[model samples]
Target: MDRTTDIIIIKSIDQLPSVDEIKSISRERALKLVFKENINRQREEIGQYLDDTLSGFLVLIHKIDPELNIVKLITDKEIEDHQNFFEQCAKDYRQLGQKLVFMLVDKLDLNLNKDFPLDTFNELKRDERQIGKVAEWKYFVHGFHCGFQNIITGQYIEVPLVFGLEFGDLDPYFFVKFILSSPDYHPLPIPLFEEYADGLRIIEKMVSLGKFEKIHSKIGGHDGTVVTDREKVEIKSNLDLEKIFVNHIKEIEKKSKFNLWKFLGLKK
Candidate 1:
């Protein structure tokens, strides 16, 4: 059988059989699911709670080898008592000598009575701390992952609204375009590519001075794959761009004993 075929997809609670049922599932079967399908090391998991109810659950079981295990539970709005159900699952899995590595597949929707100034744009203004002193930066961007979903047309559709963050004010658009332009895939649309290039130029101009600002892009995807969408770009009072570039070259030299151009068979 194909290796992926041995992996199971659990869509509902009824499929669980019982805590005893999972225990009966061999270690080899369990290991295949966790390593092959579930834990996405790229993006941080986002949880969603509905009207005081948990809507879904995706857990990877790694307490075994030869196979990985995954348990996925999804429910409609009717399941109001999901917390208790999840607690029971935890208890059951504990008995089976397995722990749950939770994953969320949907965005959280919080119902607040008033519209407080909690937006990212607003928070940036209210927080008066200096950019470099903040220590941490949040970069948010959205993009698609092909084959993550299936549409009505029976084609594996792309997941387009994926969003994520990373440390520092990295421009995510540039990072994504760079990755896509690699030998693995084609480049983004011409217009979008130009927009990203222009944004980078503006950032370069700003970096000449001590002031560093965030560049927002609607088409960019986050998850550190795109580093350019950093919430805070370091603004050193005595910034030296040339020195930084030289330092980067030295760092690259440490990793690569020979020049990159020479490695690519290009004449220096």
Candidate 2:
């Protein structure tokens, strides 16, 4: 297929592409998306639902209502090469519905490849690729240390390093070891401390969002903090800590007696 051709087009969740519109597109372009290694009746069934005359390409339309999230596509073969594509599509659709917003295709595919090359998404040239049109086109490569910072200065920091964002999904131990072992890079003494801090930020954000009461309970507490009976019960109950943390932060901010800087060990 010609890279110049706009094979797949992304529309707002509110707007849907009809099966006839998809069928009108060239067959080869459609087939590239839907074809699979092994033919499955399920694919055909989905195709039938989208369009009766699915000659060259099979059309799959998955609509998640309430959020009005929709993914409409035509492929010549089944999606057998990689499972990540379908999973990402589903996740994107779900997120659209939940957030009631549009997000870049890259964010949707964060979990698509556990090991996709970092430069796979980096564009070699401008105008070579359409941003939101192409389905499988590379978009952006997320940096390795997305939120890294210097501890003493509390300033955002970036090491002279570049890693494929795909490693973000794999087990952290392997990635951490790889970074530490690299002869070119001198890793911080307390690498795990940074990871823990990042995790804590996520937990604190969750608490602020009112998603759960106690995140430490679910993750077995922070540092060596013991899980009390109440925390254990909350963990067993699977409570959300996001909102709790949000409220807690608000309360702390309002209290003049509390000193968060000291609590964070940043104050002298």
Q: Which stretches of candidate 2 lie over 4 Å from their true place?
A: 1-28, 31-58, 61-167, 170-268
Who wins the lDDT comparison?
2
Which ranges of candidate 1 are over 4 A from the true structure?
1-193, 213-268
RMSD of 1: 24.3
RMSD (CA, Å), each prediction: 24.3, 20.8
Each candidate: what lDDT? 0.28, 0.30
TM for candidate 2 is 0.16
> Can you write out model 1's per-residue Cα lDDT over 1-268, one digit (the tens) per residue?
1112244333432432344444344322321232223433311221111111221223332343423333222222212223233223222322211110000111222221111111222223334311111112112222222111112222111121222121223243432243233332222221122225433443343333323333332333222122222333322211343354467678877897677688799987
Over 1-268, each residue of candidate 2 has an lDDT whose tens digit, in order, gives 2212233222332233465665576422322223232433244454455555544332344332111111223221222222233233223322222221112225444322212222233332234432332222223223422223223332221211122121112112322333343333343322222233223332333334333232222322321111111213112211344454466568877887777689899975
